[model samples]
Target: MLAKGKDATAKVLIVDDEPAFRLLAERFLQQQGYQVVSTASVEEAQQQLGQFDADLILLDLALPPHFDPQHTLNLVPQLASRPVIILTGHAERDLALKAISQGAWDFIAKPIDPDLLAVVVKRAVTKHQLEKELLQLRQATPVSSPLPSLAGHSAHMESIHTLVQRIAPTEVRVLVTGPSGTGKEVISKALHQLSNRADKAFVSVHCGAIPAELLESELFGYVKGAFTGADKDRQGLLKLADGGTLFLDEIGEMPLPMQVKLLRVLQEGSYYPVGGREMQHIDIRLVSATNANLPDLVRQGKFREDLYYRIKGVTMETVALDQRREDIPLLIRFFLEQLKEQQGQAFALETGAMQWFLQKQWPGNVRELKNTLESVAAIAQQGVIRLSDIQLLHLDSQGGGADTEVVDSALLGGLDEQVKALEIRLIQQALQQHGGNKSQAARTLGISRQGLLKKLERYGLSHSSADD
Candidate 1:
């Protein structure tokens, strides 16, 4: 069930070739007091967009004359903040989700349920108005206390900003949890910069990336002749980060012995460097992040429960990109600006292409979005990104090698199947981007070589998904 929105002055542009269906939908929309404009094709819709200010769009997924379902979907940018509701004949849930992912706010199957249609339209219209209002308020408001470099205007992000501002100055140990590629490091950096010891070093250590045997030495460097490799008195991250902040990423992967040592440091406000008898006092804040379930690990005795409680003085949970979807456009804008700076050429997106980006589900979250946009920007024609350009990026197989492109075609499959196909494709692209170097590819993809190799095998990539 959905709430009715105060949608006065909202306009809906309907793109359906069928006259009877158009008339019916027009009647339905008019009955709800919405101004309706009906178009026979995407080209007509484009023309209508120039003169009419629409707040929403109703697109027929199956259009006449070579029914490319994604035809109108690719044109969403033209509508700007307008929400699009797709009308389709299929009752399949995947198709609906895919439609929404492709930029439609919602999709209703043919022989439309009037109640459902009305509710979806109302919600979409309400959302559009709210977003517009938020944008305006942001633009009008003074930046007396500006947020960190994390770019987003969604409610979830706003809440995060408020929480960070409140908690960052405090000495409480913070635990950040989110899926991989969701900008945990960025958040950690913000925390460090906002803290009282901003002038001192903000040392970051990846618990999972460093070897277990070397992690202790890396965290608490030893004195000269302390171990085989210890040639001089080396300052560890703990010493370097003294009077500042230490961000331990992937904290769930930290070894049990290291966890004990860390718990001791947290409890006693001091630590002894490896093979050193001297106790070193510390004055630093600890910020930890992990994609793994720390509580489950604690239950399994893999992660120390006491240590978990100590680190998680306050827990900040970051929502996935899909969950906070309205922020997509802001992120896209941020990335485009970055691209312009790097390329030294201005780039603008075509409306339809921008819509596709807004609707596309980023499994790798912000990282995936950034990489995809970078690939597209690399070859955009004369600094203009067309819908076809983005489509080509999605269609590009192992590498962008051929004039005639190759798409996996697995997108037409079930959701899980599409996901698997994309994983394989991304792995191939990663390897290709790194010139078939698996280690480099692994780093680029944000996975260990072992993890990457396991995936390569899973996707049958051992037999030439890459140059090797």
Candidate 2:
């Protein structure tokens, strides 16, 4: 029946041996706008409970021939914060009191009352949700007054935080490059938040998602009747970000014409709206990011060289998940805490699950990890998230080969020489793909700009060559 209501859609699990009783209970619950799952025995209930979170458990106290109520009561604490209600045909007052004393939330008389059952179920779910919300608030609310520093014990993350702090106060055009899901946007936002212009707006634009035809208008805006659908005057992202910061994601995808326009905006600090007679001036700080090679695009004439130089006044790059595999454990703990707060479940990953998560070659990077955690959290039972709980949505082990092959092929030489050769090849490939943008090249290689610079120094490949 699964009726639709904002708060009435909590999940309910009904465990009873009587087929008729189960059917009637399920139907009544469905009509009340709840998601109902029924099982004939405690064993079946336990199995199903491991994979689905139940807001309330409706337990029939009279089990089959060999079943004991005490055995069932032992499993109650296993569920993550879920409340259970007892159901039985026994009319004795002492029996009901015993059941309630054994940790049942409420006892319902068998041959259930449909209307009364619905009201009790709704009240139990409401109470559970309120308690969960209060717990989350207590966990999330900070005790200290000062804003917490963006600190990471990992050397790689520590370096990034240091770089963010150093570059935040300046108006330098920063180019942040990283593989997909490597937290480039997080770093960018942190840069904006810690900067001198923190009081102003921070506008984010995904360059790849916009169609090329509308990108110009979206960036620079348009006057009324500028095009067939343009009925009203529009303010562009650039104008909206005036006296603030504009974050350009997937900057490598910006078409050459738009690159020229972006270059002009950076150079002149002004732009004219489409079909508008006047030029508008804006004060803005630009932060750009990409996961592609920009230098190669430049070599292919797909990117503007002048624009690359202008936007990369200062540069940073994020390390890939594979390169910093040691951080996976820390990340997993952080995500689990977040999921506990978000889903109202105090679930811990099983040892096998933790090992599986650590061993995965996360090509999709941090985003893949978060998604995996979310999936596991949704299906876990007994407050234990097991390896079987996660359904691996995608396998991207193939992408790790290029970097590995490059390293292995160069290992015959001295460490310095091998590293140099590997650096040269990666730089060439990245530059050729990205059109002479070092930031973009570094992203494709899964290394920071400073790391890329160190590699460049080892290979005797100058910054001037990357710009070319």
Candidate 3:
């Protein structure tokens, strides 16, 4: 009467010397609806792995003929690119921790509790399946010719490229949504490059970065003597973008009054300059991008619904980097190649360094990963990058960003407890800084809005709300 695993095809390889332990583990995993492959030795496990793409491995610390825990743990990665859970006795807990440091996903102590084993194994297997799916999706692509700036081979990236290829030829308004570092602007540029107006001027305006009072004049321009500072005739983004594409970045931050004006432009395609008697008309395509949740903003009455609908002719969303981890290695290689071209020297990552990079959460997305690599490469000697080089930079020491608060020694409790405390504090700070706007806070924290909501619920801050 056991329930099947979510991923029924998930395979687990057990490498243990004890026959009884192996049998028990195999039966338990099989009952959990996983394909079990058992091996009496590491050699047999290696042979089986060559034939079976195991999603996870149950490795014993005391595998003969190399009974040395460290040596056996070192061989885990060589076995396969999968999660390895060390099987250890209560007395061997220290060795199990060492196994983790040596790259094992987790460990289960002897006299294993079936419930605990099920939980740990299920978690690891689920993660493995997700990673596998991403890999398969990437490999299934027969051809990959991403835009110059949009260098990704994952299925998500492929879909984005396909959408752009289909929609780029048309003059539709596109609303790009996602986290800040996810390259919304790059997609916007691609739209312009593929459009019929490729040669025309492509003007960009950041609605959030510009002040409310100045944003109006910045977009619509002012005539000579319109104001004290208006010395002569000046062109605005709308005028400059005539016969081309006008990209509005962070359009959700446009003031309500400015939103009304933008609506008029989008509706009538005509606007008079500041203090101008004559109206100017422009034929242009509109492409807007924002990290904020426009629908939520519309509901809050901060964003005009009519404007949102007008600007949202087509919608595209960029996913967070962690969600598409299969692209990490490709991105690493791409960045390394760029570095070589720029610095006139070849750079390479050690196996351990590559594994370390793959294991990171990369909250800041592609931008953070690129920055970390640049920092490490700058100090790496002889163009060889290793885990030590990364550790020396302490790039991940303060959560994931350079601006995060540093951990203080005065904080009491274990590492996990202190880290949890820091997370809570950071979430509180983010919420306060953005006035409880969850979407904005999530962007600032380099996480998806759903991720932030989950954290808020977990930390019992679900009631926190303001302009959201």
Per-model TM-score, in order, reads 0.56, 0.54, 0.56
The lDDT of each candidate is 0.73, 0.70, 0.77
Residue-level lDDT for 224 in candidate 1: 91
Cα lDDT of model 3 by residue, 284-366, tens digit: 99999999999999999999999999999999999999888888877777788789999999987744466567766677898
Worst lDDT run of 10 residues, candidate 1, spans 405-414
Model 1 TM-score (2 dp): 0.56
**Candidate 1 lDDT by residue in tens digits, 1-468:** 111224448878888889998888888788797888898887788788788777788887667665777655555433434667777775443454455444455556677767657766777777677766765654454332234257787787887788888888899999999999898888888887887878888899999999999999999988999989788888888999999999999999999999999999999989888889999998889999999999999999999999999999889988788888877767776677777788788876654455456646667898888888888888788787755566566642322222222111112111345566787888889888988887678657654343465456546767454433
Backbone clashes per model, in order? 2, 16, 0
Query: Sorted by lDDT, highest first, which candidate order results?
Result: 3, 1, 2
List, residue by residue over 260-343, the lDDT tens digit for candidate 2: 888888999999999999999999999999988778888988888888888888888887888877667667666777777787
Please list the residue runs of candidate 2 whose C-alpha ends up more than 4 Å from where it truly belongs after superposition: 1-152, 344-347, 391-468
lDDT, model 3, position 422: 93
